[model samples]
Target: MDIRQLARGTVEWDRLERVFRTLAERYDRTVVRVEFLEADNWLSTPCVVDDEWFVKIVTRQNALVHALLTTGRNVGAITSGTGGFFDRFETPLGMVEHEYEATKRMREIGLNAPRPIEAFEVNGLGVLVLEYLPEFETLEELPDEVVRELAPELFEMLATLHEHGLAHGDLRAENILRCRGELYFIDATRVLEDRVAETTAYDLASAMAVLEPRIGARETVDAAAEYYGSSDLLSAREFLEFVRFRPDHEFDTTKLRSEIEKVADLDRG
Candidate 1:
């Protein structure tokens, strides 16, 4: 069994059944077909309803796990000489609501994201509904050449978020999707509103980490340099080691740091 599955403890069938029934009633349907997905994450149990809506069932256990992860991330941030910027939600509803709003906000600002349907609690479980993208490829699943071609576009999208005083607190390759040749971001985590600058730098660092293995470190930095300035790169440099510590991320941090420093030096010169 996957360790993530253990961490994201299974929800009782009776409770899940209640959720499905509620969804069917809410959508005015007599029945609904649920297709459970083996999505790799500890935050939520994901599924598809009637092949139209992507649904996430957030339980109390998921919320507890999220709080623990948030603490660890904040500690990493502090160790990186920055204050904690990641926010924690005490309840499952908060988690689902935040993602719903985040997706809506991203689309409002002309960024590519899933169409959020709604977030509501049912029998103490937080249920989130969104438009399902039937055909898609995560960045990790795509070919290296395809990732290389999309590297700059990824940076541009991140820049657009920062320009609007927002940040994608979680930016693993899994959260970025490609559907029909267009990029779509999903599962944005909540961050402290007042620390947008810190979150932006951390997001830049995370993006570089995701791309470095698929493309090279130099190319990764070059893609970022197009949308970010020397100061932004320098700020992101502080979070490179911190981002490396994440379990989901594996990249050559030393080489990436060197590339970022070289570009920053050139900009300074």
Candidate 2:
């Protein structure tokens, strides 16, 4: 279907406008205009509506929708893109369909994720409305205490995903959202099956790499061990081994080991 039709298809433009309006009113703000944010590596053009909310228009070839965000909350609708690689990739509408389905399935399995509001297809573009989370921060910038609290929960969720034979293709700090003492994962576009263990390991390793510098080695190892509930998942020795395995990435294990020993001592004390 065409862009106009898609915009007014499953979700009537009137209804979408109302939603945006309601949000504006509820937040006591006004959106006078929509501005273009960064477009490229995922078409994300945000409409600047006053200072309260930014209506992000994200589109792929066959799918497009506006993601509404307040200064504090991220919530909005999914829509189709009007141009770019949509045609070049010849990406079937099925990819979007699968993504929403996977997200729902993950939620059903008790995974921490954004709540899906609604999903439909218009003019070949798939769209989903999801809960907007506010006052969230990325895991990369979180404090050690916060990371300690989040680590086990995240690992538990990862373990569940592995147990259920699912994997989030792009598992990274940016994709994880933390709000009000809870963690919510976003961006399930690359969900896959049959490689859960490998995928989980890769994600864990990636998270460790990102967290190492910020958290230091010992606390990092302690957190991993605590999260995995087994020294085997990532013991201090194993962590050192893993670091050594990748000489290209320099890490200080001496400090890490000391920290782990200190944690152990604390536990005993």
lDDT tens digits, residue span 31-94, model 2: 5443333312232323344433434333453233321111001111011111111111123245
Clashing pairs in 1: none
Stretches of candidate 1 off by over 4 Å are none
104-137 per-residue lDDT for model 1 (tens digits): 9999999999899999999999999999998999
- State the number of backbone clashes in model 2: 14
For all candidates, what are the clash counts? 0, 14
Report how far residue 46 has shifted in candidate 1, in Å. 0.5
Each prediction's RMSD over C-alphas, in Å, is 0.7, 11.9
- For model 2, the stretches where C-alpha displacement exceeds 4 angstroms are 1-92, 123-125, 227-269
lDDT of 2: 0.50
